[model samples]
Target: MAKYEAKMKETESSVIEFIETVENPKKREDAYKLLEIFSEATGYEAKMWGPSIIGFGSYHYKYASGHEGDAPLVGFSPRKAKISLYFATGDTEREVILERFGKHTSAKACVYINKVADIDVEVLKELINRSIKFLQETYGS
Candidate 1:
């Protein structure tokens, strides 16, 4: 495996093992399904960003402001309280989704949801795809 994939594997294996041991079978299944959906939708191999996030794809980015790094194209971490989906746009320009999404919260660049059923997965994919295109056009990723 490549270095990044190897590192992610080492991290994500622990996460999958932890999830398997959890008390809630439903949550574990849901998380696994989410991983599958995201993996298929993004067409990126599954890799762990950390203990909880199963990330798909990888890209290198550098801003004109002299900031640059590599990051996953799509990622999510299933936590005890919620699942956090990682994307570039959070609240600044996603007013449409803000009104459409069932019940979700956000930070500067991530979306927090109680469950996948709570939001429109198709719409979410559109947003992610659009964001990726935008990033590529803007940053040449």
Candidate 2:
């Protein structure tokens, strides 16, 4: 069997350059704000994850099946339709916070918001911290 490789590994690509390419002015601006927020919250400089995601920190995980990969502890992508917030899944506190996270939609692994103003920044920070803690505890520092 071939060794598994993750496509979204960290890159030397410039995060600021990627954000500048976001055509939507509002989304671009929101991306900048998110960059600041995630940076402050994670205390890690942002890195470009794949082509789109602005990621902070990282962790390695291996499933029971032996699939292993590294992923950002917290990240986001300002897509054309919505901003995707990446956090640790299966976190009970995360679910509770999402209930009061203001206007947004969520998938199993991502929370989607139309813009920064649509959600509570304080709550967002809490989510970032929670995700980092959860990943660290589950996977290791």
- Top TM-score prediction, candidate number: 2
Off by over 4 Å in 1: 1-23, 90-93
What clash pairs does model 1 have?
none
TM-score of each: 0.76, 0.97
**Tens-digit lDDT track for model 2 on 1-141?**
777778989999999999999999999999999999999999999999999898999999889998899889999999998999999988888999888789999999999999999899999998999999999999999
Q: Candidate 1 lDDT, tens digit per residue, 21-63?
A: 5456666777787777777787777776656667777777666
Residue 36 lDDT in candidate 2: 94
- Candidate 1 global CA lDDT score: 0.69
Instruction: Indicate which candidate wins on lDDT.
Output: 2
- Cα lDDT computed for each candidate against the true fold: 0.69, 0.93
- Clash count per candidate: 0, 0
